[model samples]
Target: MSGSGSQGNGQRLRADCERCAGLCCVALPFTASADFAADKPAGQRCTHLTAENRCSIHAGLRASGFTGCAVFDCYGAGQRVTARPELTPGPEMFAVFRVTRPLHELLWLLTEAEATGHGGAARPLIAEIEALVDGDAAELRGVDVTAWRARVGPVLEEVSERVRRGLGGRDLRHADLVGARLRDGQLRGTTLRGALLIAADLRGADLHRADLLGADLRDADLRGADLADALFLTQPQLNAAHGDGTTTVPGALTRPVHWPSGSSPARHEAPHRARGMPPGKAAPVGGGSGLGGRSGNGRRTGRGGRGRRNDRAGGADGTEGPGRRPG
Candidate 1:
């Protein structure tokens, strides 16, 4: 269900570390955990960030104890912010990243909104955000996120409404669908935005063009679920969840590299078996050089974590393992 147009839009929402100035590496920090190997302070350059802004340990983040860094996605803000003409490699970049990152995230959602035929409803907010993203550094530095949200939230709500309307009259927005049985269901164009789908069984379900923006999918099962053209489904969401090689993700997305290489029964092979699935679709969850992936396995690192964020107090930010949202 993912047409070419949607895939291009989805790629823009992902973090391209190579195009970034190692902002997430230096601007954010983390505490030692299943995901992170140590406690770091905001504005401190990560030990792994190199002189050229490449992560020295990117390929081995999980092995190095920094899995949280592997799953975090900047929604393309990192590269945009790093493009400032006078930008230099220093702690000052953290201030700019914090201000601009969330705005970029808004673009992620807005892009999904547009892709799902809700562009007209989301256009105003999109234009406003575009102006903000394109504004001078001083204006961006002085942004008021509260006002921005108040103005844009309603448009987001409208976008959600339009998407839900296309889901065969279902309004599953923000629904608590954790551990629920929804196998082989028809769920096209559904608004699952902000829904908690943790550990839910979605195998063999058709979820074409479902708006998954902000939906917490940590540990959700998607063995053979069809998420073709699923809107706003990011690599971070994929990294947080479990899926076998059989899961039909949108062409724009890649399967999380940490998923278990295990193969169990196929749907056609065991049609009578309900809940017949691989116990887990991923290897032990942890951070890599960024958010997470198979550490030191030579497989590409996966998009990485939701950190213990430090937006206002400027405490520390970066990866966290499962159970709690990032600190």
Candidate 2:
């Protein structure tokens, strides 16, 4: 139910590694799990990171056991932090990144809420957050993100309620439904915020208008599920889950490259145009230029790469999931 005018706003929130200083590669830590090939401690650079701040294995992240890198979306915070030369590659910069990452994510969520036509109540908060994002490193680091979330949470919930007013969906916020069998279920307008749906069977489910803010979807089966209008659903969440050509994601997000190819031609074409890029021109996986004519991490090598995906932090349990790093 998002208006077309604001639908394109989400593009600005995506990660643009070209303008970044490889913050995620160095600022965050990852265990040697299914998503990462090796253990990388916080503040230490990944071995794959190159002199130019690009991932050396850009072309083969998933194949190289760096699937976590492939799907991480910084929501544009990496570039924002990199814009300040004084904060480059330092503890202050990383700390600022930790705070700004969630703020940018809040911006994305509020933008989506506005698109829903019920976000009139969210505009003021959006502007306030935007101003905070534009602040200097000192101001940014001092921000109380927990307090901001406390303020923004209810506004988003109100938007969700208004959007799903008549659907009478279930209230399952913060529920532990890990691996539950809910395939082909009627989940329309459900409030699934912060739900742990890791590896749950949601195949062929109807999730239209469901509130998906902060939901952990690692390994969740979304094949053929309808998320065309899911509330607050993000690219990182989509990247973490298993979907196919039959899966219907929101209009703003692209079908993850790793998803089975050649299934949803119509769905595939819209995201490119939506992101203002021509077909097959999105920023290559794991950004930066090298082998296979692709870029490092999830960035495009040179200036021509347009529309990079964003990233998210880990779930509430403080564990790394697909497309998510530890918070």
Candidate 3:
């Protein structure tokens, strides 16, 4: 699945909500589910929303049994709207419009979240919303938003078309895809917890502060991508995506496995920090219990070998090491 991002040329294509009254949320509908505390119809007010156009339950939503509100993330849509210079509207209108605007954005995000048969159409529609939100409403008041939305609806239909083709598949858990080439692709803050992808291609794609716990990578390539201050993307994702030999992965992450040009046999899984050594440790010299060491046709080398020897070299069965059998 992919999502659009707030970076690249597309970054300039986002909506400026400050100019307009909240439109999307007021225009949308929702059921009274655990995520939402009340059932609201399209064009209705949310009870928890304040008159000043802010969430009244902002701080206490989770404790108030609105866990859904906690998980909701708008891809900087609110900031973009507020940043517009000429698009200022009154609080009265904002109070009524805030709900719809967020709802519209939510629908748009959902449309792009999955690889549906309508991805192509949905993408441009989302783009249209971005464009509309970016422009001065006074300038666009003459331009029929309803007609534009109607025109863009079919584009959403086409979103499914592109999605069916299976063009992009990338999991960026705490991945460092800064400046990556993710043009017109999807990856809107997809769960990238503890992934490593230094400088990957992600232009015109989505990535709104995705979770990026202890990911590992160094100086890769990230042109035309959207990182936008992703969360938990420690120095490793940065270094790996765009690092040199001097680059170092974060302590939480293990060193990446460097693969040469040609294909090689699959190695063992690297160990986590708890198993006496960190991840990516080499196999024992001869072969013993090792998560990622080589076997049969391969030999441990350099630091990997050293870590392996230090960890598994000790034994009590009278053998020289954990892997080396007694003759």
Candidate No. with top TM-score: 2
**Model 2 Cα lDDT, one tens digit per residue, 1-327:** 422224545556777888888887877666564456667666777788878887778778779877667777777778888887676688888778767776776777778778777889779998998898777779888887756766777788788889998998999875766677888999999988666565677888999888777666656778888988887777777876778889888777777877886453222122222235322212222211111111121222111122323232222111112232321
Q: After superposition, how far is residue 43 of candidate 3 from its true place, in Å?
A: 12
Show model 2 residue runs off by greater than 4 Å: 1-8, 263-327
Q: Return the top candidate by lDDT.
A: 2
Angstrom error at residue 259, model 1: 4.0
Ranking by lDDT: 2, 1, 3
lDDT: worst 10-residue window of model 2: 287-296
Model 1 segments more than 4 A misplaced: 1-13, 186-190, 260-327
Q: Give lDDT for model 1.
A: 0.55
Q: Per-model C-alpha lDDT, please?
A: 0.55, 0.64, 0.33
lDDT of 3 at 42: 46
Lowest-sum lDDT 10-residue window in model 3: 317-326
Q: Of the pair 1 and 2, which is ahead by lDDT?
A: 2
